[model samples]
Target: MVTVNIGTLHNVLDHVYGAFMHRTKISPLFFSGGWGGSKLELLERMIKQLFPEVVGQNCPPTLVKPVWNTVWETKTACLREGVFRTPCDEQLLSALPPECHNARVAFLTPKFVPPQRMACVVHLAGTGDHTFERRLRLGGPLLKENIATMVLESPFYGQRRPMMQFGSKLLCVSDLLLLGRATIEEARGLLHWLDSEEGFGKTGVCGLSMGGVHAAMVGSLHPTPVATLPFLSPHSAVVAFCEGILQHATAWEALREDLAAQKAAMTLEEVRERMRNVLSLTDVTRFPIPKNPDAVIFVAATDDGYIPKHSVMELQKAWPGSEVRWVTGGHVSSFLLHNGEFRRAIVDGLNRLEWKESPS
Candidate 1:
């Protein structure tokens, strides 16, 4: 069984985030997920396994332990008020190993909830009993496929608190919003981080479903990501939740209810308009096109009843000559159906980044 120490993971990530900030001159990698499947968890495990010793290096005394000293979730920094403060690396560096303090950090903003808790539970459960099955299914073979890592947890089964929260923050400013301003602001903040001297260098984005939309938006805005891979997802593709294609309640409907209850300053229509304006990444698609003119790879499910393939095609056409990969499956099935193969592609793409090759 692969033994993971949560405390270790926490400290290492802080330093790694600092290291990536130092090396890439770009923001930490942004990831989103399609519905279903533990994409975030799977990606973290894969990265750890692929680069076991790549944990942060040259740690300071203060980073040797795990501490929640940051104001991320405190009452002072509530998501409602738009105060998303995280603990800086320097603040947490004294609690980590001396040899592994400054490591590359992959800043992940999961779409749904912070899947950290659930992912840990799943990992722990697999460790005790179904160790072998876990490895074959989600850990070993599954991680070998799939290229791009996504962020959001699947809201198909139920609405995720974080996405709802993200939606709420934006709805206050305008009604009938598509993507929230907070989400966009956070995304842009990451972009600015990337453009800095120490963020990820030449980063890329890949997402599924709504996550796909996020990838499109970020890629459209940032020139760093040389490659983009969005699979079977789009922004306006709301068939499943809207028309009951999947017999599910759309996030839009839920947002309306929440808005009604809150009675905030912004009307639903105004909020929607603001969201549209901010998230209109499609409009600025031409801005971030690679200078080399290489087409990005956009994957879709031809049989995606939830998020129709036509939407994917529209993005392809709109991009004026980009790569598209159409698979045979529905929205969720597109990924779950080909878990192993999908994971392989994700790894290969990330491996393309030229990291300072460490001693094997």
Candidate 2:
């Protein structure tokens, strides 16, 4: 009899898939759009100014309602597509490219759930996830469990992608930061609307890959208790961009030259370190722990190429009482094959939190 390590097998597949896509010409390199010029400086300054206000504010920021259109309908659920101006403040707004000036979202909810038992989960976008269908599909079945789905379109993706950007290959370092910052603001606003407006009895936020990172931030910064689910996500963008498969897809030469132009002439290693420094701002572990750490769940891949187990565990450790569930598969495999597990995590995480008190 032979014992096989299924995890190693899938991990190899991930490595092969990543290498073929990144090592060859199949996928365009990230940051190929070159440096964002002044936007980089603006983002750096704003992050210092804005992180505390948005994430650590004394009161929640004002929320705005979206103008929605019923894009699709069905017997069990109706889907409403919505458009709202981006909620990022003036300085950050000016940093965004015109195309991403507005935020877009798709929401799917069951025809009915008792007001006390109603639930809604906001799904953030992962890299290259350009539409709501995939996220909706993941959250759709949960409607049976009375969990609605709200899919946020990440800035620099879908209808929000900038004119000069190519596919998932972000044009500049600042573009990446701006996208994350704007996403936090918009997601926080939507969560606020869901809690204070729609009044879902229970609300949670979840995402996979890059979206997972954002989900963790939103969950952490949110004023109230909400289930936080991060599936197949690293503790920080530093891991994804500097230490994982994405490193191959990074435009090292462009970054080196950009850093060189920013300060004194720089070497390739110096630029890599600088990139690490910039991406460090995205470490969710560095963010405040959610009010309900017990309500946080991380669904991680056992053999993920992009997100190492260490990164996932690091976040779990930082937020004590958060649970980590290990599913057998690699990054791509887990995303494609383990959605049932992802859905299960969402249900369990949401269940851990107390229902929000309904208004009079």
How many pairs collide in each candidate, listed in order? 59, 0
Residue-level lDDT of model 2, residues 248-331, one tens digit each, is 989998877776666888888887888888887787877888999999999999899898889998998999999999999999
Q: lDDT for every model? A: 0.35, 0.87
lDDT of 1 by residue, 1-360 (tens): 999764345334434543443235342111111111232233223223212143233121121111212213332121111122222243222321232222111221212332211110001110012112322233333221221121222211112223323321211212111122123223434344433422333344555555455556545544344445455665442332232142221234344444455566556565445334433422323333432223356766655545655566666776765666666555545556655444443444444444322312
Error of 1 at 84 (Å): 5.7
Q: How far is candidate 1 from the true structure (C-alpha RMSD, Å)?
A: 19.0
Candidate 2: worst-modelled 10 consecutive residues by lDDT: 50-59
TM-score, model 2 to reference? 0.94
- Give the candidate number with the greatest TM-score: 2
RMSD of 2: 2.2
